[model samples]
Target: MSWKQQPAVVSAPPSEDAVRIRTRSGIAAVLFLPALFIAKVLLLATDKGGRCFVDDIACAPFPDTAFGALLVAVVLALVAAMAAPVRVARGALRAQLLLEAAGVLVVLAYP
Candidate 1:
């Protein structure tokens, strides 16, 4: 038998729900200060020293540690939202917005 290569196939564009989920996730990642708080809490719980560096000294740019974490979280949230059959894109986006707003308020109030 002889083997032959087949041409590439073209798939349809992503659905509206997929687009919405991706857009929301992008927005969440852009405004990641809220996720910083969550990441900090988790770090404090898991690691007594929460320092990113080798030494135990505190770093001023500590919140920068959450950047990658928040990006991954946002991507995961979009994936989860896409998996749901009910298409709750708006709800997911709204919840993210609310959380971000609350986080901002808390940060402002405390600091």
Candidate 2:
């Protein structure tokens, strides 16, 4: 390689800690969104006879580690708020959330 071409130093991939920090920051951003943050309370309150499903609310942000936390969180909140009959949705939503949590946790732990 020419001296001028190789003059600058090569950059390394971000450290695991840095990557995890960035991921957490991104998740934090999702959580700080006003509407998303309050989704649990609103969904439960508006739910008539516990018939509402996660799909009722557009699962915004698609499926990602950061947003997944929000999804699981909202579900947990709703489940906690529900009475005797827990109407947890029956589909990939729960599984997806679980996967996200696992993925994020792995990243956080080993990134």
Candidate 3:
């Protein structure tokens, strides 16, 4: 088709709810990961069975190295989400939240 024959494209501006949701999601992406990580850390530290064999003053139950790495990854993902373009930030935050929710469920369900 010739350029003159093609119709012009029109796109609607994003609604207030959509922008609000994205803004809130971005803020949640920035906040929730650290809170979740802290909660997990507290849970691990308070589990009496995992107590350290050495100096009690300097020791607490240490979660798996993999878990620590996962926490770091979540933080990095949050940073990425915040830096992402407006259109992408919402999806990034949603995906991060889904991953975090799954991680929380796994931690809770583990025997």
TM-score of each: 0.42, 0.28, 0.45
Candidate order (lDDT)? 3, 1, 2
Worst 10-residue lDDT window for candidate 2 reads 83-92
For model 2 the TM-score comes to 0.28
Winning model by TM-score: 3
Separate clash counts for every candidate: 0, 1, 0
Model 2: per-residue lDDT, tens digit, 1-111?
A: 655555777888655544444454345435444434344445445543134344444423325666567556645533332311222322223443455455444333321
- lDDT tens readout by residue for model 3, 15-46: 66566656766676667657666655665565
Model 3 spans > 4 angstroms off: 1-22, 26-63
- Which candidate do you rate higher for lDDT, 1 or 3? 3
Q: Write the residue-wise lDDT of candidate 1 on 82-109 in tens digits.
A: 5554367556665556555544443333
Provide the RMSD of all predictions against the true structure, rounded to 1 decimal: 10.1, 18.3, 7.5
Show pairs that collide, candidate 2.
Answer: 16-111
- Model 2 regions more than 4 Å off: 1-5, 34-111
Candidate 1: TM-score? 0.42
lDDT of 1: 0.55
